[model samples]
Target: MTAPLPPLVRLPLLALLIDAALVVLFVLIGRASHNEGLLGTLVTLWPFLAGLVGGWLMIRAWRAPFSIAWTGLAVWAATVVLGLLLRVASGQGVQLSFMIVTTIVLGVFLLGWRGVVLLVGRARVRRAALLATAKRMSTAG
Candidate 1:
């Protein structure tokens, strides 16, 4: 069997995969709403993908991939802003209404998952603490 990846490598890889999946999902939903097919969805995905790469670089997102403050906010902002800029440059429409919708939708997609992860992490920590406390009490008594 193959060896498992170290945390340094594994965390960033997982973060990138999750971020890419969310971006693709955003594109897929938007395309479906317009009754567009796969090719059109992929065509629309390029600018957003570019923005995601730019965001990852800008935030050095791998450092704290799961942190909402470090990764989630920066990634969301960069993806929406840079994505629209690239889209505009590519002669794609960037109307105000579309921008607003894109911002809200992408924000929810990107930040929502991070928020869930944060809650779960906190819960796990709390549970561990409680378990440790109980073990100590039983041993002492």
Candidate 2:
């Protein structure tokens, strides 16, 4: 058996990393053009942070089922919608196309990673089960 990781969470940590990366990207681009206003900062930070938290929740909720693709897609769509609504609330002029694209990319990556993780974990479990069965058969024989 593989040793357990530290008591610290793995998914949320991953989520934070993703959030930070995206936020930095947005900040850099905004700063480049001097468009990094308070509204822009809010728009960029809110979605990214929310995405991280949402991704963490989705992973935790569906970790057992391990269906990354669909769950990731769902969470992505939901979070994007949530983010856009937030933007609307803040009176930011957001375009629908932008939201769609953002949702697609984020959903695929966030959920896709989880799906891959689930696949690897499942494979490991299956391998372990097969090994145990083989051992049992050998001893029985």
Residue ranges of candidate 2 with Cα displaced over 4 Å: 1-42, 47-74
lDDT string for model 2 (8-118, tens) is 556545544654465455445544565668766665667555654665476563343235555555555656666666667867667877676666666656566666677
Query: lDDT scores for all predictions?
Result: 0.91, 0.61
Model 1 worst lDDT run, 10 consecutive residues:
33-42
Clashing pairs in 1: none
How do all models score by TM-score?
A: 0.93, 0.57
lDDT of 2: 0.61
Top candidate when judged by TM-score against the true structure: 1
lDDT per residue as tens, model 1, 5-114: 99899988898889889999999888887876877897899999999989999989988988888689999999999999999998998899889989999999889998
Task: Report per-prediction Cα RMSD to one decimal.
Answer: 1.5, 6.2
Model 1 alpha-carbon drift over 4 Å, by segment: 1-4
